[model samples]
Target: METTPTEKKSIKNFFAKLGPGLVTGASDDDPSGIATYSQAGAQFGVKLLWTALLTYPLMVSIQEMCARIGLVTNHGLTGIIKRNYSKPVLYIIVLVSYPSITLNIGADIAGMGAVGNLLLPGIPSFIFSLGFTALLMFGIIFFNYNKIAAILKWLCICLFSYIIIPFLSKTNWGAVLQATIIPSFEISKAYFMALVGILGTTISPYLFFWQTSMEVEEVRQKKLIVDKAVIHGMQTDVKGGMLLTNIVFFFIILTSGTVLFNAGIHNIDTVEEAAKALQPLAGNMAYALFSIGVIGTGLLAIPVLAGASSYMMAEVFDWEEGLDKKFHEAKGFYITIIISLIIGLLIQFLGISPVQALLWSAVLYGITAPVMIAIILHICNNKKIMGTYTNNRISNVLGFATLLLMLAAAIALIWFLLK
Candidate 1:
């Protein structure tokens, strides 16, 4: 079955249209996300697999709104808030966002380093962490936006490894189908906590900033006019990206649920642990693929995390900023990125547990997500800001639904934490 030229051209065209959305979606399943999904599958089996299905449309709606905001205003989410909203509002948003995003970066870097060490025992994990940090810094500062984006785009293939891992294991397709389509419920604090973490991970504020800014960057680099066609393309890219994200998520859960849970290996705390556990149970191939995927996703995600923070800071302070520009041209932006990576790397040496760091980050994300979603909805609906690009009725419905859902998740998380 050889592909014809027409099929090849269509496939190429599909990938060509996948810019910001594709990369963004791929980045969402970072090491931290992999760990979360792994934990869910290991601890609860396929009970939570339905979340992957549930979050798809919600994610698409929110991301589409963010992309639309970026296309219309030519500014990142932070910039839009800074311009139209009050000073304290913007400051509060930034204040809550930095720690969480930085902590997430740290956890991911640590996960990557741990997995690197797992792959090759001779090298110390910190050495691998340092090497990766330096590699990311070099690439981000030295490479232009187009090259870096292409690298990230290609890195998306790493997620396919996860998709393949499930098939390597003896997965029960009927059980997986039942878990995916039929929603499951549990009345426990831990269940709700995991649910909150998954929600926070999937629909994050940092992603909102990144998506909006990347769309602006896309338009500027290509000089694409913001019209119906452009908006439609952005929507398509976002939908494709989010669909990819959820599919990878589902498969990861399926792999762990079928392999680890059935083997009585529950409670996976880290990506490395998940991989190591897979080796003896599911075989070496599963372990190797999972470990490799962690590193690849780290490469893809760390930049997005650092870049999101940098973009937010640059936008708030009105500094010259862009991944498209040279480091010298956007010193503040590049400096913020470097500082984020540095802090993230240093966090591992501070004796903080990666699990605790991830937990706190999830908590912060839960807090900020609802507020940001509300603000985004307000911005997208405000005629003064969006003009004709204001969200349609369907968009508004989905947008508000996402807001209420996150708000509920946040409240539930807080209640459980205090309990």
Candidate 2:
């Protein structure tokens, strides 16, 4: 089992080149994602497991396009959209998307506070929420890109608890394998809603903006000039990152589906509920594992939700922005991040159900997805911006399909809501 020296060097070289992809993949497992996977397994069993697998390629394709655009053009999505598209178009899209995103961040902060309370029963949820929000804001404002990325990377490692817990549980591997490979469905409105929720959670628009912006940051971090060859490397990095993300997602569903569903626990309103339900079947280790995953993913995801919204706002308004820049250089950008975190913290005081807030946020994301996808496609295909790196025939085919699928999901979500 021991590796040769040559093999060891190769492995080290591989890891040395891996950066942005790992971060992107890790962020995908945010607190909202943990809630979605937990709810799916608790309610529908493993029936929706295939969705995780199916979503991986779609996510990779969309994110790779975003990374490519950022690396090739040396601009974020909003900057490109503002320059190429009409002001009216930019105004309408940013107006609607920005507020919804900030609202979702608030909901995530509330959810984090609720989950934190479970971990530390003596702490008040509101205080913990507010304190954590301030800490995150301060970290982003004061820390350089390397420090921020390092902190986020460690937070991401916390998600691996879910992977370890599944093995400790008495999993029905035969059934889990079946569910993962085979597609299943029901005709009820609730089923449709759940489907919408899963799609929204996985193919999030904020992630697209964040991943693309991070690529630009990565370029600056390495002090690399923007060029065709470098852009291609960025695409490879994106694919590698998303691949890791999908692998983690698949296992999350596998663990929850096997442990929670098979036990006949059909409803879970929070991560704590899901964790406790696994105790009788999967033991104390399972509970600890689930709790740890929730805390870790929440920390990793909250900043992303806040930061992405900040980047979009700054870019659209032409404010200087980037984690690499000093505080004075990006004052508006840092201030916007703080304001978003504050708004998110305020939601905890409203006494709203975190689960309900998460559900509604997912629905809102589902509704907005189509419009964002349309804009992303237009921007990526524009030769004026992308130059020779514009999306080719295959990219267009995949991108178009992704857009159509999201549109259908959005329409279906609306229909279910109306019914």
> What Cα-based lDDT does every candidate model obtain?
0.93, 0.78
Q: List the residue pairs that clash in candidate 1.
A: none
Reference-based lDDT, residue 210, model 2: 85
Name the runs in model 2 displaced over 4 angstroms.
Answer: none
lDDT of 1 by residue, 159-246 (tens): 9999999888788899889999999999988788788888988998889999999999998999998999899889889999999999
Task: Tell me the tens digit of each residue's lDDT in model 2 across 168-237.
Answer: 9677778778888999999888677777877887788888778878888887788888776776677666
TM-score of 2: 0.95
The model with the greatest TM-score is 1
Error of 2 at 380 (Å): 1.8
TM-score of every model versus the real structure: 0.98, 0.95
Which 10-residue window of candidate 1 scores lowest in summed lDDT?
A: 189-198
